[model samples]
Target: MADIISLGIDTGGTYTDAVIFSDARGVIAKAKSLTTRHDLSEGIAGAADAALAAAQIDSREIRLVSLSTTLATNALVEGQGQRVALVMIGFGEDDLARDGLGEAARAGPVIFLPGGHDVHGRETPLEMERLQVALPQLAQEVSAFAVAGYFAVRNPAHEQRVRDLILRDAGLPVTCSHELSSRLGGPRRALTTLLNARLVGMIGRLVGACEAYLSSRNIAAPLMVVRGDGALISASEARLRPIETILSGPAASLAGAQFLTGLDNAVVSDIGGTTTDVAILENGRPKLDPDGAMVGGHRTMVEAVAMRTFGLGGDSEVRVDLAGLIARIELGPRRVLPLSLIGHRFSDIVIPALEKQVGSVHAQRNEGLFAIRTGLPDSMAAGLSAQEASLYARITDQPQPLTQLLTTAPQKSALDRLAARGLAHISGITPSDALHVLGRQGQWNAAAARLGLDLAARQKGGNGKPIAADAEDLANRIVQRLTRQSSHAILEACLTDDGETGIDPAKSRAIARALDRQPGVVRFSLALDRPLIGLGASAPVYYPAIAEELAAPAVIPDHADVANAIGAVAGQIRETVTVFVTSPEEGIFLLNGSGETLRFVSETEALEAARARAIEHARALAARNGLAEPHIELMEDADAAEIEGKRKLVEARVRAVASGRPRVAN
Candidate 1:
């Protein structure tokens, strides 16, 4: 059987990790490389090559390959993705107001057509003529399209029709709401579909890159992708519904934590470049969020581990809060290219720029900031506006000081938009740079970090004094702020799990007093109920301070850095399908599932049909996901009421799940 070795890969915001593992021998070898945002294939191939070389294994010996990534999660948190247009069928402007769809849609164009369906799976008059007139123009304005119709879950005919039109005419990727979730909330479903449409191009490219690299290496293995719930799915399935991968990396980390530590109950916190993901482990399993996975304040309908993702990480942008006298330091919600990294790549420009800023009498607002081209193809920049295109043109492959690039305040906004679209990257001081300055880390150019910090330290506080006396002092302040924010993020996740209401650890005075250990008339202290399992490449550098703040012990496993990669291959293939049977009228049952609706005169017949359809769909999905034979489980939730001593059926939901080990080559 050639030992049935499996290869796992995780492409995170800052790094790509690869691991070779076997069921009998465990992890054989692992390697990491800096993630290449411009072209992810470079990072993936680098990591894979290193891991294979370390293991001394031939590429042909690998039986299976699996992957997990934080790209979708990072994009959502940073509000970065391809520009997409939303097609709303039979939805009013008011519909966009619901579920924050208006905010999520951003400046993307929206086309509302007079076509949809009712709850009874009856179609309203569809205006295909109106759609025909608008789609041609809309296609030129965005990279992809999202089709969400009223009551799409009950009947997806309208959504499907629109999708077919967009795909056939414009040849652009289209996401239909019903294809994502069967839930009834039209606006929220539309929002999810819209987000999914935006991610298709990105995830598709990632998969294509992996497949291409594997093919070139002659590693003929079925490529699988880790889902948000730590299950494996075929790459093709992942491409169609990339939104399901929002927490893919975090979920894999949770599984990895449990496998590495053998802990049944603990709070697992995994820190990456752009986000820190926190989740609770109970009974050797992660808890699933019933309300759906909420990331970046958007409640998505994707099934995933109950994880709280905070935009605090090593590569987080270091911002100074000059509103207060002390000029408090705050770590990111937005990731920037670290100065240390930029210095390593372009030291000639970075070091000189920082030295000039530090030598100046007064530090400017954009003193230590720089921008560079992301190296994405010009095709990805197709939908840029005039201002965005102009700003993007000014940014070259070489780093340019933001101070030199932006002439006016409005130009700054234009540059930000360019960065948000993944067309450009802004380089600034980050915690990773702080670590370099303090001699805690030396992976990159420390001289550049020190220079950047010197400029940062010269900034005036509210008291009209320097924020810090020296570069080292500023570095310490930044590290301390990161620890504090990390503690708050962990506390908030715990409090939310404990069902605490209206109490945000970040803003709570009582929690602050406890964390700061401030003595008063009445002393207060807070501690986690369970131990903290910190997983990341920099966990050892930052987690001890975070653990101290929370009064909890921190456990860092030996393989924590590559946990996501390890977990990617240690997962099973799982597929779920939910079918709904609703009583639309007296003695009439309507069954809806898998984009099909059927009517039955008897309730018994409809329920049976729903269950059969759910099971068939689940098994098919499992098969498509590379599972040869799956074990099936069926669950039913029936809602009925007794009215006038007679049983009346409201709704019945039948759910079927198929799960099995991923098929591997012999």
Candidate 2:
């Protein structure tokens, strides 16, 4: 409606990036800011202000703003969602475990009831009085409600009735499972609905804040969000289907990669401050995994660009193992030394202060000094008395002798994970902990990690053996072992997802073991020939070798560090709707919405309808995003089944330019 110059923003774990584009100006400007985990809006505003400055234009010149962020994904991973109640119209306790719903529903209470409908739309008798009794208590505790019933898509009456009751009593936002996922499988559907409800309030606030920021700056652009599948959607639609934006960051990287390489099909990898993400693109579009994927830690059935994430990044922790067979491993991408430690080492300030306070020059005896100067945690500092603190300081200054210290602290945790199959222990602490130790999330952690590594190298191993003769090598190994496990797990998961039947357990383990070794891009390239494209913040550091390994040119564009932001800005609005058409009689397949029945015939007419539907859906999404004169691209696939007749699935994509032309400056 307004002149449609659009601004796109992408907020990652460590940075917030913004890009402003005008058709008239081509590309206006872009800006970046450090992401503030505490209050995300601060980072958003910072990025916006920077972008405005870069464009050298008043905020009023901006028309529409689109944003994609990791805020919701972070909330879920950090276990920080609002309280929610699961209102199941028909489910038993056994249903949770059977459908794999129990895992994601760990946060909320799953309430089962007596009402449900059959596949043919007939209602199962329900106990209204019992349900009424449970409603009040649930209403008091929960900020939101998620309603799911067996076969709700076939007969939503039971779910609707429950929704009506919840609206009257709970006075909270509610998400019907049927609305979120049109597929069968009650438990999976319920999980999706519950997740949607949990994130609704948080996402709403984030969007509202962004909108207000733009309004305050007089940027009147229509807001849009990049979906997880690398397609764009209106802000309102994204809010409704926030799950689709779970991997929005990675999707943006792929989009940016495609734009950079101008190659439709290739493997794209982005290495960032904390992780490296690898994904594949087909036909210039990021591939989508049909089964929902995991983000942070929870699993959700949202369409996202398929990717593998590794925690190996710049800020990982370095450690040594002594209780075990004399090895050292880094504890984190999350933990690190602060730059202040380096500054401290170059001066007598930190060590002298430690010696003065503790009344000891002995590194071990200077525990208080170690805590204050090196930013070690109380628990860790307390592990060392004043004498140990002095020793720690000596090692922090020249840590080649403290390998013994690193080795001793983590043996029990590693053994428990390996010997007891309790990976829970090995899951390292987050970067947040390291930040807290340093008194700042970013700068301090970096300094501490560097300082800690230098000190750790001086220690002995479990066998009373010296660590690697090379401190750098030892430091690198420790970091790799700690951060690479997640990468190992994700790659294994992808292999399993490739529809391999009855995978040999030994082969799976072998593959994981190889990946754990952190093969360079060359090794990975030999294994898989797909071209590798790097996208995350870490990409610059890792892509050259990765490109070499893949034996294909790797493209890292000007905005490579903020590839996701570019993707978020560059994507076109799109949507997808899947409808299954079938007939019980088995000869002809009838589409429910259109009442069009196709007899046993050639592929032409069936193909046309399927493509048309896909186009129609895509066009509608374009329209919603203010795209005028939308164009549709259709794709159709049909399968023959023994149980049901010929089934056709249609996928459509639509695109259009916004109605308003870009404004001319000067």
Q: Which candidate number has the best lDDT?
A: 1
What lDDT does candidate 2 reach at residue 571? 71
TM-score of each: 0.98, 0.70
Q: lDDT by residue for model 1 over 1-666, one digit each (tens)?
A: 356799999999999999999878999999999998788899999999999999999999999999999999999898888889898999999998998899999759888899788877788888878778987787788898889999888888888888898888999889999888978888999899998988898899899989998999999999999999999899999999999999999999999999999999999999999999999999999999887888988988888999999999999999988778889899989999999999998999888888887788765768789999988878778678898888888899999887788888898898888888888999999999999988999989999888888888888889999899999999998999999999989888888888985698889899899999999999999888889999999999999889988988899999999999998989999888888888877899999768677989999999888888999999988988888689999999998999899998998999999999988876
lDDT of 2 at 535: 65
- Give the alpha carbon lDDT tens digit for every residue of 601-633 in model 2: 433454455456545654555676666565444
In candidate 2, how many Å is residue 278 off? Answer: 2.0
Question: Which lDDT values do the candidates have, in the order given?
Answer: 0.90, 0.56
Q: In model 2, where do residues sit more than 4 Å from their true spots? A: 1-4, 22-28, 74-80, 126-128, 273-275, 294-299, 309-323, 328-446, 452-461, 464-474, 478-527, 545-554, 578-666
Best by TM-score, which number?
A: 1
Residue 34 displacement (Å), model 1: 0.6
